[model samples]
Target: MRTSIATVCLSGTLEEKMRACAAAGFDGIEIFEQDLIVSPHSPEEIRGLAAELDLSLDLFQPFRDFEGVTEELLLENLYRAEAKFALMNRLGIDTMLVCSNVATATVDDDDVAASQLRRMGEVAAGYGIRLAYEALAWGKYVNDFEHAQRIVDLADHPNVGTCLDSFHILSRGADPAGIEKIPAEKIFFVQLADAPELSLDVLSWSRHYRVFPGEGAFDLTGFMTHLVRSGYNGPVSLEVFNDVFRQTAEERTAVDAMRSLIWLEERTSVALADHGGAPGNDGGFPAYPMELATLPAVAQPTGFNFAEVKAGDSGAVEELLFQLGLHCEGRHRTKPVQLWSAGGARVIINQQQARGLAPAVSALGLDVQDPLAAASRAVQLKAQPVSRRSQADEAVLQAVSAPDSTEIFLCEATGDGTVAWAEEFGSDGVVEGEPLITHIDHINLSQPWQHFDEAVLFYESTLSLVPRASQEVPSPMGLVRSQVMCSSDGAVRLALNIAPMGLEQPHGGADYPQHVAFACRDVVALARQARQRGLDFLPVPANYYEDLQARFRLGDDMLDVLQSLNLLYDRDEDGEFLHFYTATVGNVFFEVVERRARYDGYGAPNAPVRLASQYQRARSGRRDG
Candidate 1:
């Protein structure tokens, strides 16, 4: 399978887009006409440059509004298509994409459309080119792929064939199973794109909101499976027009585009293998069997091995950890780092060695069944491997850099990295009491506006984590979008947060506060103990308890107990949740949570209260860590 991407999906000049695409290992490219028209390089020069970079100029696109037109307008359209055909010949490209008419169509008959397309195909043949007719979701007459294929059949010309676009077909609820009925030779090309499920105008949605394959809600695996089962093995290309991709860095956008395609291929192959073939539909797709390359299975994260925080001044951070029932176990053998452990939760504090590096989460360690297999899967999904200096005696943990610039260390579940490294801390394991805080419940990660979707796809593809639908969170400042990703067996959890569009730096250069939530059997006991240690908890307002009383209808005894302990309360159809927070420790904080009766949520209804308290602290002249 040859991989291809359109030039319009990236940001930069045509030359820069080409260089990024080639560097990302794409084998072919679809040159949008506007990109060519605005280029400083001539047609021949661009052609030579593509050859030098080992890329095939697969398709020159988008000859639009040519079919289903008046006879006089048909003549005018033919004359216009001739000029584009000449340009394609000069650029050493053979295929041109002809979209169904969205405007200027006085005739709406399929016979009229077919006759016009046949004439266009004859003219294209004169220039040694082929016409791949595509149906726009909002086309006046041919708005469906079946209708487009019918017209292609009526045309009965050698050079006129139909193009299949996943967005156009899937967005309008068109059935893709009919693709297997069409002959392979007539399926000229395929353009793949995915979009979120939205209620909007089709034209505007296709032009502005199209995302790469794994980033959206489309069933691309089913779509691609049907197409490949039909015996069409041409270049699978991407034609996305996203507002975010057009403004981001060209190299990053190109790499993301390529990664999405790679992920799609692997996912579709796995789906095929699992189902034992295509869904049976009258020799529909089961006729053609697909064999795809396989990689190691992805291992779900077992538990958090450790959470590392880096700061210039480590004294205050250590005091805060100690206050939360975590005692310093020991120091690293070769580095200036200390380990703090509770019941099963571990925290690492590393003194900053690099100047200007803010105090924040720099790395995370996750326990997995097979560390090497997990690393191999990550590499196949296009995650960048991170290299860290290590002594010969220390275990070399497999690591990768996430899109948020945090190193993800994968350690063996049973031994070695987590247990063996404890000896290097240079202390025997002895601590106070079976601590109230037991294990990590979840971690909240803040993402920039542009990197949010990419980060979602990265976590979903690289770690086999499942993404829940995004929800709007009300904040004192504005609405924040939050999405949760977790393992199936309820072991690993991540909450990804993205600020409103105009407020990327929502807190005036304040880093998005990263908080670690620990699970506890008795959160009240943990809160009382923390208060005794002189921990400054984020103060919740009195009005919050009143609202909670009305929402849950709890007795006065339970309500007074919650208010006294400074705990937030929430309840769903399933169960109840009680959680409390600590003050910000250099843009990092801690939360102790007790989940009852299978409560799965993170108490999102109480977020406004927390935000209000944090803002109040900032207004009271508190400094950011």
Candidate 2:
């Protein structure tokens, strides 16, 4: 099916929107009336420009409030629509979308609406144009698509048919199964949009909160499945009304829109095939008849490559690493960088003079099946590619920058992946790895509020990771939204936490919290070893240990061991998790965790206690001053 987008969905001038849509590989465009009214280009010039861009002018919209009115008002609306029909001819657009009346409707009779719409259709037909009547969810009289369908059926003109918008149907909680009941020929055009389930006025929600498919809570896979099964194979166009998209870069937003359509089409096809019978039939469904290209199947990530830390004050960061029991393997042969290792976990400390002293996590290295294929998929999903200069023998890694400006490096999954880069490090002798730490358990990244949803969609669509239902945890300051994305095998786990709106910190300070948790075979022994290295564990209140004993009814020996080590413990039905945190090193921190008996959580119940402890420590230092 052809892909198209509405001009209102993007920012910039009409010409800019056209260029962006064409560059993003859209087949056509729905020319919104407001976009044309505000443009400098005449209708003929717009038509010529679209032709040069190889884009079809799919539809001209919208002719509104043209039905269900008094006789005089109805005649006035018809005359107004006739003017638009003439404009569509000049713009070389055959189809016009006339939305059901939202206001100024005096008549409630279907016959009255049918008569008015039929007159408008006649006017459109005289100009060799078509009319697609849509039911807006907030329409005064005809809010349901079924009601609008009845009016169109009554009008019964060749140029008159129904326009189906997924948002209109789904936002009202209307069953989309009725779409299959409508004849394929009567389905003149389809508009697609996805939205979060928000409790607000329908008009407000539709205008301010609509997102692209796969980015929100809507069931777009099922929605598109209904459309495909109905044999309504027109351009599957996006008509988003998002405040963020309007302010974002037009080119970027356009690319993101196209990616959503591609992902939606493939998912719809898969859903149809899974049904296992005749297409659109209630029984086992067959493959969808529409043709769409499928992306390469993403292989689950096996492990992490390396976690990179960049600090203007590299010495402080290096000291913290030593306290965490990571040995400094060696310095890079050419760059001012040091490599730290503990069993399977590796950290690169970059102290280039050009970088600032504010401590931050600059990059994440992912171990994947095919680094090139992963990067290709990211490109297809509109992630920005990043390149770095390297020497002749240096290993090349695929990298991209996420929306939050975090860099991700893709490296080979197994066998000599990081070892190949050892030639760049100066050390010749083998560096002994730490015995306690096994691998990276998980990485937690704090995101700004505005970019949270975009980040979620990026990880899901690009890396093929699944997102768990988001949870809001109460924090000392406000509620923090935490979303986890992980692979099927639990190899790559990322926790994306978002600060509540208006609480975003300035860049370069403690703008966001970032932490790397290292898996350990034995937390008790590792904590003892780490303490011997002069590690200052984040203090846990004495009351916490007392409560832990009371809550779990642990024996005296276990409670004594946990208290002595400053460890936090949590138990669920499946298993237990024992973990401890190091004092904050600028905005970054470190964690050592041991998961027992299929424990998958990150000890969320302990977060408030941790935050309070950190706060107390800061307050103590200020009082000492």
Candidate 3:
């Protein structure tokens, strides 16, 4: 859909930004004026480079505060704009983004603004350039897009039109339905950005906290739907001003920007299809001038098949699993891996490639309706495909690498909940016991600071998982930003956490802890059995139990059992959640949870206590060592 990005959205030199954009398959780029002013290459040289890279220099921006001024300032602004127009001609760019007068606007009269804009338009037309006038959210008098459009109409110049920016419109809570009323031809350019809902000033929010579409709280799908309905066929470009994006690698940020656009396009198409753009006909909607490509549609994963942990020495992990009531169902015939199961929950212990690395979650196996199609969609979204070694008799699972370098294996879902690959783990027979754990409830993965947002977009776009609003949980290290991504159903929950600042290593390879939680029918019973088996439970402080009693007013018997078992308890309007954690084995740990009467939360209210306990345990361990 003619994707484009602004040079201001990425890190590195202008040349590096252009190269990264081209490599990421953007059709064009809007050159931010500051990037040009700082470039060693002249405008002509930059134009040549864009041609050599087969990239279009779509627009030069941003000419600001040009209208709504006095006669003397108007003449001075015109002189300044004329110089930019000549430069645009040299750079082979036909359009310039003129932001609404945020500063130096002595006159707030519409006629004065329109007259000044018309005069500037005449100067731009002389150089064969168009002006895409945009409203700034913090503009002095021209903050609203409708206000800017009215001025554009009054100007009555062919070279002047409106540049609709999603951030400007949506951030101000302006209704985008007005866009359809404006003539499509007058919609000269469009810039897209998504941001979290914040209570801060609009300028501060737009300048620093803008995130890629699907990674933030904005209703961009609705925004894009309205834009598409408006029939504006201009390049849908991203113009994000994020502190994080500006510091990340240009290549990585460019790819992330392109992925966001691709996801936005797919989502917009689906929204349009839902709103009367059905198959076999355009279904009462006007044909879109810009074609939006749909990806291979995939359903959300049904459930987690297995969670794989890699450890150099698997003894501690093996013993911990045994204490938790999971038995070694079988060992891989030709690999240094073993499969442990308790009912439908499975954990794979793989030591084949662990080397001397600490224990960590290396891969996740998800049950999907169509593994091949799911893998195909993930690969199309720029996920690197992972090819695992398998013999002819072994099942060949479709796999891809997540942004955090975790392997995601898309396994075929079975009606009977049996995996064919499990057959490869040949052994005598299933262990005999009343299964304590029923299945994998949820998994928590730690993400690097830089890749946290990228990982969110990756899972949302590639796996069709929807992200819940993020929350910050206090830990001994710092505040941990945690967001949950899950299927529409209660199944398949993934909790992604931005590790507390100092705990993570570079490139997300920190020894930051992660855990796999298993669902049990009765967590109290499970905790009792685990204690009998000598499991080292992560101790809950006495103060936590006192607070729990004060909050819930539970009876003495229930509270005593919970405190004795070191179990954490929480209750919502829906039901109760009781869970307990195992002591950490390297960077990995386990959790057993009992969800009562449709309780769907992850016990988020108790996260701070758990984090404090784990931190205390680690510190004590260090002291003992």
Residues 1-625 of candidate 2 have per-residue lDDT tens digits of: 7999999999999999999999999999999999999998999999999999999999888888888899888878877888888888899999999899988898999998998888888888899988999999999999989999999999999999999999999999999988888988888899999998789999999999999988888888888778877877787889999998998789878977888888887677667766763343445445445565566667767777789887877776787778777778889877888888778898888787635566768888888888898898888767889987777777888999987778888888766545567457765356565478888899988886656777888888888888988887765566878999998888889999986553333222446558899999999999998889888888888899889988999889989888888999999999999999987766778899999999999898898787667656654662110
Ranking by lDDT: 3, 1, 2
lDDT of 3 at 538: 88
Which regions of candidate 1 fall more than 4 Å away from where they truly are? 278-291, 415-418, 501-510
Q: To one decimal, what is the Cα RMSD in angstroms of model 3 from the true structure?
A: 2.2
Ordering by TM-score? 3, 1, 2
Better of 2 and 3 by TM-score: 3
Look at candidate 2 and tell me the lDDT of residue 507.
21
Which residue segments of model 3 deviate by more than 4 Å?
Answer: 278-285, 503-509, 622-625
lDDT values, one for every candidate: 0.85, 0.84, 0.90
- Tens digits of per-residue lDDT for model 1 on 222-256? 99878877888788999999999999998888888
Query: Which stretches of candidate 2 lie above 4 Å from their native place?
Result: 275-289, 352-354, 415-419, 426-434, 501-510, 542-550, 554-565, 612-625
Query: Which residue pairs in candidate 1 collide?
Result: 586-625
- lDDT, candidate 1, at 554: 90
Task: State, as a TM-score between 0 and 1, how close model 3 is to the true structure.
Answer: 0.96
